[model samples]
Target: MNPSNQSPNHTAEDESQAVVTRRIQRLSLHLMAISAQNYDLCIVSCSSRGKLEVDKAQLSRYMRGKHREIQERVFEYFNSRPDLQTPVEILKDDHRELCWRQLLGLVREAGIKPFKYVAEDPAQYFAIAEAVGSVDMSLGIKMGVQYSLWGGSVINLGTKKHRDKYYDGIDNLDYPGCFAMTELHHGSNVQGLQTVATFDPIKDEFIINTPNDGAIKWWIGNAAVHGKFATVFAKLMLPTHDSKGYSDMGVHAFIVPIRDMKTHQTLPGIEIHDCGHKVGLNGVDNGALRFCSVRIPRDNLLNRFGDVSRDGKYTSSLPTINKRFAATLGELVGGRVGLAYSSVGVLKIAATIAIRYSLLRQQFGPPRKPEVSILDYQSQQHKLMPMLASTYAFHFATANLVEKYSEMKKTHDEQLVGDVHALSAGLKSYVTSYTAKSLSVCREACGGHGYAAVNRFGSLRNDHDIFQTFEGDNTVLLQQVAGDLLKQYKEKFQGGPLTVTWNYLRESMNAYLSQPNPVTARWEGEEHLRDPKFQLDAFRYRTSRLLQSVAVRLRKHSKTLGSFGAWNRCLNHLLTLAESHIESVILAKFIEAVQNCPDPSSRAALKLVCDLYALNRIWNDIGTYRNVDYVAPNKAKAIHKLTEYLSFQVRNIAGELIDAFDLPDYVTRAPIARQSDAYAYYTQIVGF
Candidate 1:
């Protein structure tokens, strides 16, 4: 819009509304000139110059789900504050300081108290976390460390005494703390940690110590500089009845003071070292810590599962150490849940940027005609359309996860807890791995422009790379999912009722235990391939077959090798099985979302994207389907064609699809992702 044409009262919101108005006008004019058959082609042509018409408000409402208002508030909060946005090429220390300030800004300025909401309102807290992550992941991690990890550990594991004494300070950031869990030698294997905390009966304190170099707490955020205290996880030791030595209990968490609050110096018995500059997320000051007999009162123990008396005798209701350990870690699964939620938001940013850029970037086309959008090219669509589809799929899946977690919190049902834990683990692994890989694909799709630091793909990719490693490594997490599935598989035979997540297993196993009928296997109609039922069934068949086959393989191998060796031999198959199960879960949730969508237009759009996601996944793994004769060659070809067809359908509405993400231009911080006037915005930002 021309500056001269604007009224004196014009605001940024007004200009944004004008852009949408102009795009819709353009779309309406083009639609009037085209027939139904040429509608998609017309959209492809019009998109180079203008946006396509979509019910963006309705779609955005649906995509944002229950937390739309909170998310929008966060996005607007950051969008209005230029100071909060990290400048390109800032020093590491400056970046870390910025992250800390940004987090504080969200609390003091935006009034987003994720720490309080962690227990009071989990959904809202995660919504805030995701929005913050979308704008700046450094801030996201910093917030997670302070609220979700450190503060959450105290709330979930510590009792009323801990909450009364510490909750107010942690909430106000007066007592900055870190979650000290991972050690130099322990990343995923928390049980193998070597740090020891022996109860001192004489002093009525727990003496924390790092027995060896490998036992030092490593990669602890908020430790090197900002943290004053730490929720240290160490093996609890009690004096044996003979008084000759100490008996080791399992891992336990204690509130150990790491630095003096007033002096801002490391405590006498504590040592801290900066982990140095990292490949990404340098805004977070990762650090390592070692304790030389750090002592804290016996009351410092987070004794929800176990505790020691003043005399140093330990007592717990849980009979076994393994149960105590499981219970301890289960309470801390919120980290994985938050990561899965935030990872989806990060993927949304990447998708919106890349897809919008593709629409703006015109390139080679047919002879004697104007250059066409790269998005119109079949190859480009192939690269990005399914990615867009999967983003939506993951959104709904994660939303369901968030809902389940909230439900578990309210009920504390044992089965519900296990379901939430397993679901979070699987989704975190699958989604982060996909998002990490997709960032590179997105960067490459944007060509050299993506490589430029100003575009943000570099920073986004770098910061998100660690997500797959932290919150439990992807490989280890997936193995846990597979193990959970195998347990349910065993229960199915014993006539035991399945949990809500794996309830379909009983029927699916019975049906898929036999081969699919010849007629159904060979059917190749577009309607058949696109059917949600058929897609879900295909996914279920793969998961069920893998479960059965892997079970047989494990049992056969157990004769020659012990159970551990058998599991090691079948690790690859187990990972695949776990991935298949997660894929099925995602598809099922996507279908449920489409079925329940209130707006017809939004539902139709979602159905198209769902088809693309389902068919793309099926086509990618066609080899397995073909091997079992589950889908004949002709049917497989049909699935491929329909997948491509659905991609084109999605490409027609790609603008609306991305807009539904509802990220402001400032939040994306990419010139190429501007909603309107791409050339003008790009040139102005680039000083061309």
Candidate 2:
């Protein structure tokens, strides 16, 4: 008998269901670990309770198991209490002092020790964030979101020791620190930074100065009002190496005190001012910083990777400056991953609101003049279900990526580290951009009410809009991934033996040219297109073929045109291919989990979700198929049929869909999404 056939002694289900149940339990455990890392103490506390209670019976009845319902109930219970809910309201009520106080409270709760003077221990901060679910980090990120646009870096990219010293008091709300790296003229090119740290051998100190206004740090988060210290990145100039020229001695980190604790005045060489507010995240006082002739102890330098001796000689364990810089860049990967998860959180909140509202708000049609819920409409299902599916997709993908990232860190695999970094950057760009767009669509799906601040969609949109640009702009990040892919293609193909690339090229060419393959249609029955596995395979094949074709085309183009020109010409196509690859990865992972679902009802619901995800992509890429001879007109008709079928299937599952999200009534705070009885009662009370 297959292992799946083995029955649990207590339950009467067959082996297949048992296996799926076990798989779900395993996956749930995995999710719990991720939640522990991503959520604060409050969130983790609630989620832990829910996880313990999730059961098959509950899962069958509601798309979400009992655990999810418990999670929702917990939210409802908490939000009903004035104290917890009051803080959220007050924080939103005032964007200044009250908000800061609330933020301080959250920071403390998030494990920042009170009365501390600095954030010298970055790991402790990360540990606290992990322990508390990063609520404070989110607040910090939100504060920096808008400010980052003007150029301040909120998340510090510094070593453990540097954080221990300069960041020590910040945890206790004592001495706040800002991250300063980008110069007015330098932007993303850290290599071109002109801030210099010269060795003063006589005094045994490092003299730090900005060569000009262009070299001044233009955008340092929390600099204008909050920060009293900074983690400054600069070029190290050796005293005796004057004749050797500035040979890229690698970027070194340093701690510089910039403000007087008692007077709150700028130190002798440091100047600061607030950056005026604009689009969003205006609460943070992002500002500019100028360093004149600031002198700090030689030991103030963060000497983890590179260090200077008292004699003014510089030495580094890493020989290559480029590799060292890349290593520094590597530290920012976590932020990118964090941003990806944050984007998912934003979407979750939006979907919860939209789904609940859809189930409550009623409109036209009559059964003895009864109003039908908006979710009853197929059009609404088409608009919202794909996004709902995508939330799960992103959730699963990010969880998996985080797992891979943790494993790589543990093993210290350089190649794995680089790959995760590149992948995280691309995925962050893809997920956040889509989530932002989807949230807008979900907002519109809610109609006029969605635009109201009280409805929460508008605020959610405003808050998430900045995610697209930060953690490196989406366009720039994706372009980097494309560049990496192109390099891989060249390395594999440009050499003497082109075995792998040639084989991929041949297979893709055959598929594109419409050569008949048995496996291609094996899964396609009269209703094959409707089969969830068939749809998944289609995404897989389509993505693989697209990537192969693009890689080959770029390679061929490189032979004739200059490398730069060829890359420029192929940029759009390459990025699209990467997007398709990512989509396929997400779809594949979602399908694997869905296939492992034990409850038949859940399997059915997830199947519809899977179909909706695939159909959405097909709709977006209809032109691609239309231009290709491989896809027949009949196949095009099949795509539309799949869309219509999935749309109807989604409508049937909308109530169940909302249940799967498990949003609490209080967090939603939308009258329409509340239970119908409550909605009616509230409407009456308000005289609506």
Candidate 3:
């Protein structure tokens, strides 16, 4: 049967394609709508329903003509908001709540709904967001809960039947739940979890219990207040076997209900506590949980990938227990993607604030003389423009990554899975960490007023910092990617041709021994980095070589020490290598996407931004690139010139830069970002 003809509930190829296409269209429209509302600094553009004629031609021109104009339009749009004109103090307390509320309103107003069971109807959930043209699911999920009045639910990865039975309920939000895995003392180490689930064959139940205080689940979102059910991970044991015979059969997942809806109280043997007042994401209601001899039906065991029979026989689809655990850990890739998208959203907000403020606020000129916009200053440009460039780089990379994620979801191939996992881990680490750091830099660029709550920069920075830790700690995530690279390196050298290994050995040695090459003095105006074919090849080669070198070293090192020992010994270096590799990929992806864009001006500006991004990295890692012959001394000079040129070009387009973000007025209305016209009105009202 044609996949398209299949029911929306089933896997249909045609349906998937249609869904993807529609999403692209919706996203384009949303971008266009935002562009129209933000084109002029004087007019306020609010809701999606606002009647504004988006000049496709002008937009096309802006995209093709000059990069700075794109920056300018973005700033101009953000500058029109009055609420953005308010101080930060008044905004912080309400920021999360307001964002949450606005998101909920958007869902209802747009008639969009979230899937009740994400695992079962993941496509539906993906489609809804694609249709809305927003990637931040946190807002959508929060709103979906309020509109549906259905509590959140958890998806089981252990068994297919578990998914079949409970997934529908979850997809509909009929039973909102939490996935409980991490123990208080054994985070990221699933094999070390102490919570146990012993089979009671006679009773056909599994007795779940936390053996000690350390066995209690911590950092479980929706556990403290919202969740009624949980997909609990526990160590499986058989009590009938003598003292020495009770073996830990690795971590297993079971669907267990924790609270009774009627009384709104914890069920027997279940305890929960709120994690109260976090640094951010307060709306999530995170908390800890414990189970004392909680009995659940044997059928509750989530055994899609592994299972236990009612008679107490254990079985698994995969032979290796570690692989099973790894499979479960892989589920967090979705969260990582979500995190990357959120980082982009936060970056957009930061860029909007910085760019708008740069264009609107002026200082340090003669009295009664026309003051220059702060953006015109080389110092200010250096501070915010690189970040602006980063925003575009992040945007392009995220879009491509998300598309790849969806494609991989279709086949469930292990290689695809591993790739997605690796990429997500790296991108999440890079984007969140950089966004957090860059947002603060942008805030500082705005001076004391930037610290004022009215500017939104401080709040945005705080909100984004959580991204670095959530899903997975950025440090830990990079380690995982590095580990994967190391594993690949070992495989390539161990059983493969010596030629491959030799090539890698040669490159690594060259990198270690080579001196800096003279920098290229080629001047192609601001479009040097925009040379479509050249940028593409450069990025591709750099990324491929970086990964190859790291993989080769990891492989070679494993020969001297055991896998685990080698990983531990070279851990720091691996992390550094992983970061370098990820950054290369990001730059490459950004350059690729921008070069392919139809607009010449947008391409040129994007090129400048790309150059800045690359140059900044080159400057930071001058020694490494110099040693490898990747960057010559003369090329270093080019890097500096590119940076200066980009800063200059971006200064003029500060207004337009903010426009590209397409934020509504309500979100950007902080006081310092307001335009001259609005400032006049505001000052008049204050009788200044």
Candidate 4:
């Protein structure tokens, strides 16, 4: 009867409906088969004998580090505004629109004038961005592109006139913009960027041009939809004094209007292309841009470090083009600092979810007994506890970086700028890469439940994966760190005073060169392994030794391989040294934090976590310690045993440790991350 009544289109429509019906039936059975497991019986059966006695809120405050109040304020603001939250299931364009709306709501309602804090209080600025990141990374980055990259460029790189002209609009989101630095072909190598800005002396204008497809600006946040202008970096070409041609005056930034504000249309000679769908962070509209003789007033150039006159004369306070480039980049160190903080936040969320779920989801047990919490299992503890310790360690380290950067801003110390830049580069690279990898570890640790998108491991992993490449690629950043280390190493031997970070280098190098004391090397006591002094000394030795070894290798190879070839040969060694130095810096910061903790209970608990962090790192690289005979076989074994023992100790306090992160249900948006009643929450959200 259906066939007889069916029209030509009706037959196809029915066939389509039949296919959908069959697919839905199959999916319904699959959901039933793999529905989230209920934790009611497990929760009831679990014993609570091993909970830590630390003050949870105090630990949270300590973990939040500096600008705790600002972070909390942001959290409260976001929590109260349910309308700002985007649904999990939406198209990319919708997600981008919602993210933009959230940004507008934040400015209009939350009064988060990030531009104000960028200069007056960068720590607060970073804290606000980190908090936004905890809610949604896309919003965090969009805010960054608007306030930090664009507005920060105006404030940091531009003159007072440029600031007066652009600051208000940028701060209020009236002129949403892009940080158009990276080009399609020149991502890490700014010196090679082909985009040119030629000054027109007669008209007093700079004509920006994209020489070819390769010169097009790429991966620019906010460029596709919202950005009206960009702080475009291009090779400055000033008209020659001889009246012959233009002189290449190196890379400089200029404010170029990309879209008409009232019409919301692409401006003439400025092309904008959507980057289309990405692996994640689809909420931010990333796009490519091309400039074909885009003309702007001569005053549009950000003239803090460098400037061009109305007559096409180029001037810079920095002595050389290299110095100018360095200064320009140094002013933007906040990006790396913010990313490091956000990466840590993401890691905290992942660790909290995985650890909490591990405690709730019970698995194998002996006969005639209640099943054990998965966290009770050694394998799970090994996976989650160390990450928990690292989260704390990175938190303290990033806080230190923020402090150093803030101090640099206040003092305007050239040394501090270099130090902040190097540290930011290293920490951003190290922490983001670690968090990127650890997301998967956390995902796997939670078993199949973590695979579900609602749990956030998938999106978190995909979104944070770029942290290794963007801002600065990890490899290049590490190389920069190594290069700086070598410069310091040379200075140390030449009787130059070392910076605060490198002061220990001389002593550590001396200690490494002298000898490995038999008594220290063979010391296997728990107290000895846990000693902050001993842990720091071991870390210092590793870094100093690596520095010396890499330096020697580079020098030896340069004789035969040439400088660039030698560097290529020693790239792996340089990376190791960079990582070792960054780790040592992080470990020292964690130790200082623990020592300074006023609460005895919190301090003791933190010491346990610190020991785990240090020993776990040492154990992971036991071969390095063993190769130099810095630790005896027995000592290495003891370190390994203590690592396991500390994991067990941390496992007992796992819930508290994660609870200290203080991510509310709204921020986590995962049913299993609930502090209490995760089972009921999981079933309710999954609707099974």
Candidates in order: C-alpha RMSD to true structure: 13.3, 16.3, 19.0, 13.1
Tens-digit lDDT track of model 2 for 1-688: 5657655673546556989999999999887765445334433442342322233344444333222433343343334444433222334224434435544654454333422211232222222222212122235462332222111122234446544553435545565666677788886678888898887889988888999889888757667676777778898777555686545476777778889888888899888866666455545556788888899998877776677888767777778888777866675566677677667767776787788778778887433446767876667877887788788778767756665566665575766776787778778999999988988898898898777666666666775787787667888788877666555556544553223212333334344435434444333243666565556555545655666677777778889997777777788887786777677667766777677777676676676677777777776776775564334566766777667656655655566665665444555665556756656755654578
Tens-place lDDT digits, model 1, residues 1-688: 6888878899879889999999999999776555334645645654453433568899888888778888888888887888888897899999999998888888888887788889978888899999888878988999999999999999999999999999989988888899999999998999999999999999999999999999999999999889998999999999887857889899999999888889998889888999999999998989999999888999999999998998777889899899999999999999999999899999999999999999999996544567889998779999999999999999999999999998887889999999999999999999999999999999999999999898899999999999999999999999999999999999999999888889889877889869788999999988888899999999999999999999999999999998999999999999999999999999999999999999888898898899999999999999999999999999999988878777877888999899988888888988888888866877887687
Candidate 3 C-alpha lDDT tens digits along 571-615: 777777678667766776776766586666666556656767766
Please report the candidate that would top lDDT against the real structure.
1
Off by over 4 Å in 2: 1-96, 109-171, 240-247, 366-369, 491-527, 530-533, 552-561, 596-603, 676-688
Q: What is the C-alpha lDDT of each candidate?
A: 0.91, 0.63, 0.63, 0.89
Q: On a 0 to 1 TM-score scale, where does candidate 4 land against the true structure?
A: 0.92
Backbone atom clashes (below 3 Å) for every candidate: 0, 22, 67, 0
Candidate 3: stretches off by over 4 Å? 1-110, 116-172, 239-243, 366-368, 493-566, 674-688
lDDT accuracy of residue 406 in candidate 3: 64
TM-score-better candidate, 1 vs 4:
1
Q: Please provide, for model 4 over 321-371, each residue's C-alpha lDDT reduced to its tens digit, 9 standing for 90 to 100.
A: 999998999898999998998899899889989988999999866544688
Clashes of 1: 0
